[model samples]
Target: MKLLPLARQAEVTNGWLRERLRAVLPEVMRRARVDLWLVVAREYNEDPVLPSLLPAPMMGARRRTMLVFHAPEGGAFEALAIANAGVGLDGFYTPMWDKTMLAEAAEDQWACLRRVVAERNPKRIGVNVSAEIAFADGLSKSEHDALMAALGPELAARCVSAEEVVVGWLSRRLEGEIEAADGINALAHGLIAEAFSPRVVHPGVTTAVEVAWWLRERARSLGLGCWFQPSVSIQRRGEHLGDLGSSPDAVIRRGDLLHCDFGLHYLGLATDTQQNAYVRRLGESGPPAGMVAALAKAKWQQELLAAEMVIGRSGNEVLRAARAAMARAGLEGRIYTHPIGYHGHGAGPMIGRYDNQEGLPGAGELRLQDATLFSFEMFVEHALPEWDGQRIKLATEQCVAFRGGEVHFLGGRQTAWHLI
Candidate 1:
């Protein structure tokens, strides 16, 4: 797969950051009903949402970075940055600090922030403080104390948690970001394809760990990075599911079922994917009928879940409806889907977890909105007749975008198994 140079990638990413600030931030602030949003972070102690807002080529926050967004009633929106001088953020945010004034004993950083807030006099002053979402809970104890002190009680009384604003900004994807993710997801799938093929796997000769490392190395070669370690495991006849795929030394053999879970990030977007493969034995042109049927069952389950992913529905609501549909179809499976973006397990509502299929609390209760991305992750196990009633588990995952009331897979999902 072809990839752009590092400098070119940075250029593209910085462009998207500017677009997101110009077009997306105001609408998201309106949706969350926040008039003033303040994001405070010290150098090296960056907030989760801070990196998303930073321009490319900048990895950490500068000394005492204070990002202020003001969209007061019937006034023009503003994105202001109050950091030390020459921070290189002036291109994106309107700089509100003057180092020269501090030398003359005019005003401090906190005093400048107070002046900005007083001038805006917004009805709802939003700060990064929340009990539910980690992305929104960025303000540290010391910073919070200082911020409250600087606000001088009157403005402090108007402070509210900016959880909704954080969620809105992080979850919402732009056309360019989504389009970049398509190629990134395809790169992930291509790496998996190569690792599962005979080019890397040698049946009884290659160990599962070797293949896993091969995947990791291949992603690195393409200038991409994995958010989690790539994992590969095996299942064979006469073995219980619990006893399979645990050992790092398990060697791949003919007639074995192989599974892998891998995730990679590039250009500020991430993808989480899980797929399986089948190793053909002697005198076998393909996998057995039972195995084929099991894969088809998984496909149907994916369809069931996709049809229920509508706009304005909570993640729990979608999970419940999908589970009911799966039961009616007599299928046994688990769904643990999540949003994917700047972070691997990105923000937004979580459909379900592996252990808890009933529903999730807090994050799961959040509703789904448009222009968001998700990893439609799930698995179905079938008792195969070819394996003497032993069950085979098949897991499928693909990155998808929810826009205009529909889910579009970034890279097309795996419909057929990778045969080695």
Candidate 2:
């Protein structure tokens, strides 16, 4: 039931990924009300929707997986791909749609695609073309040119953006995908634990830079992929510091507050986690009182943030509600949660980002739905009356879902600092 890595054939059930994607594609086609659905791609080049529609670790169209769905929905969804790599979409998909053999249009794959379109003659064709959310921008320039040449005079006018349906399909989760996403999201938290423990630090000597590297190496060796580099920092007594873009080299002195923000991508899902750590003052069995309360406040903020999860609320609505709830609790913080599914930060409803609280006009305006995964990236910045006059900072992140109108964490959040 878990969505395992594509290469691990035995670990995953076959056709599961495709089944989920196909089940939703129609909704996309239906919503757009387009006459024909055309997806174009080649080996190395794939349409924005390719991975979801593909047969995993998709090498490319040995037989491509291009597909077209004519309006009126019946019969199998038409598809095309390279010959024999076993796209296995036979009936559902056909081999190359060649109007001319290798002799004509030798350098392009679009020649064959035109044949599929010419036959269907869709009035408003949906292409992966888009103005935002770059993943949906899958078509290549050369392929665009060839498609234009083959379609002739009016083809340009026929195309329109598939952004809405594409975002809905890609960002929205199926029942089965949640099972896979939850199973692997644990890896992200595990990486955080390892980086913060005594095993990776020497207190007075080890620096955040060392822990960051450990995260990268650990993820690589374990076969867990990272969307971006991991970040580790010693919040050693600070007040106002912005996004710590890189791992700081400051020595990890005893009594310093340290933490890491990291995650790994595996199978077809991703996990995001951020945890705080305390470089124990020698012989002090626990974190300083201020640090303990700060971590506690961060956890509470997450709890309050989760309270906003309700079906049918748009990303902006949920975000506004979560922030208000935090403020009501007398908590000081920020939330930058994003939909996490097929991609690291998949295309569902975004809870919040750093600067864009009002939200982008499109994706951010999308509504929240159950059975979808999200990175509950929020923070608590309060004056820890217990720390030195310099003050301190605390932040923690965990993955969760708004399942059936309630928000639940994948594994759980770090309520206390990693004791090293």
Candidate 3:
């Protein structure tokens, strides 16, 4: 597949930004009971939502850039960028402060912000502050102090945390974004397939670290970026490398069961996938029956988890339902699925965690929404009769989206092992 040119990618991203600003922002603000949302950030420390809102190629927030979004009772909300007029944001935002205005004002950006607030007189002012979601907690100490001082006690009294607004905006995936994500995910899957093949991995000569670096280089060659370092691990007959035991220096060997945790970032969207492969020894035609059966159990677990992704249901609720279904099927496994989009572990509901499978408190309570994507990550533990009754864990993570009242894999899930 051909990668989008840098210029083309920027055009597509800016188009999506326009759609998001016009359609998504107002609804999200209203849902969170926010009349006015204030997002303030400095040069290097930008609010997570700010980057998503800005036009592409504008690397970071420039010199105390402040974005104020005011949603009225109806109609399009006001989008004002409290920065220089030459920043090329005229198409999307009205520049509230020019260089001349800043030079004449006592407290430039703050004064502009205050004037806007006074003019609008919004009932509820939402600022980025939260203990629940890190993506929503973008307000820095100095920025918060500046905002409070500018608004004074009376106006500050109306201030509320914009956690819901932030999550809602970040979690909701547009149709165009979902289409672009599908292409990016297909590229990622192909890269992983190539990395796990004999062209890159030689049983005794290549180490896990070598393969990992190859994957990284492959991404760079295709003008793509990885959200996390690619990990390669082997689980042999007697050696159980546990979850964290996949060392970079471990040498690949014949008859080893290989696993990889990989992700790719492209066009501002992210993809997370975990897949397994088996190396064929001298005369072996295929994997043993026990190994094949273990993978089938993992596939069944994937189906069970996907079935519980009901729209409007909380992640915790989905987790409960999935666990009960798995129990009914007599399957032993753990589910740790999370939203994947803007960030690899993007905004929205978190179904479960590896260590904390019971439920996540604040994040897990978030309800699922249509048009959002998730990383269906989980593992199944079963005893393999072919390996002298040794128990092994078959783990899988694939990108899937909830749309039209059903869950669909971006690219189909890995059913067969990637044979090496």
Residue by residue across 212-249, what tens digits does model 3's lDDT show?
Answer: 88988999998989988888877888986555425458
Give the per-residue lDDT digits (tens) of candidate 1, residues 127-200.
99989888999999899999999999999999999988898899999998988888888888988899989999
Give per-residue lDDT, candidate 2, residue 285.
Answer: 94
Clashes of 3: 0
Using TM-score, rank the candidates from best to worst. 3, 1, 2
After superposition, which runs of candidate 1 have C-alpha atoms over 4 Å from their true positions?
100-105, 240-247
Candidate 2 lDDT by residue in tens digits, 127-185: 77776667667877877676667777676678877666677677667767677666666
User: How many pairs of residues collide in each model?
Assistant: 0, 10, 0
Deviation in Å, model 3, residue 231 alpha carbon: 0.4
Residue clash pairs of candidate 2:
3-180, 61-64, 62-82, 63-81, 63-82, 63-83, 64-81, 64-82, 65-81, 314-367
> What lDDT would candidate 1 get against the real structure?
0.88
Output the better candidate (2/3) by lDDT: 3
TM-score for candidate 1, please give it.
0.96
Evaluate model 3: give its lDDT.
0.87
Lowest summed lDDT window (length 10), candidate 2? 98-107
* Candidate 1 RMSD to the real structure: 1.8
TM-scores for the candidates:
0.96, 0.86, 0.97
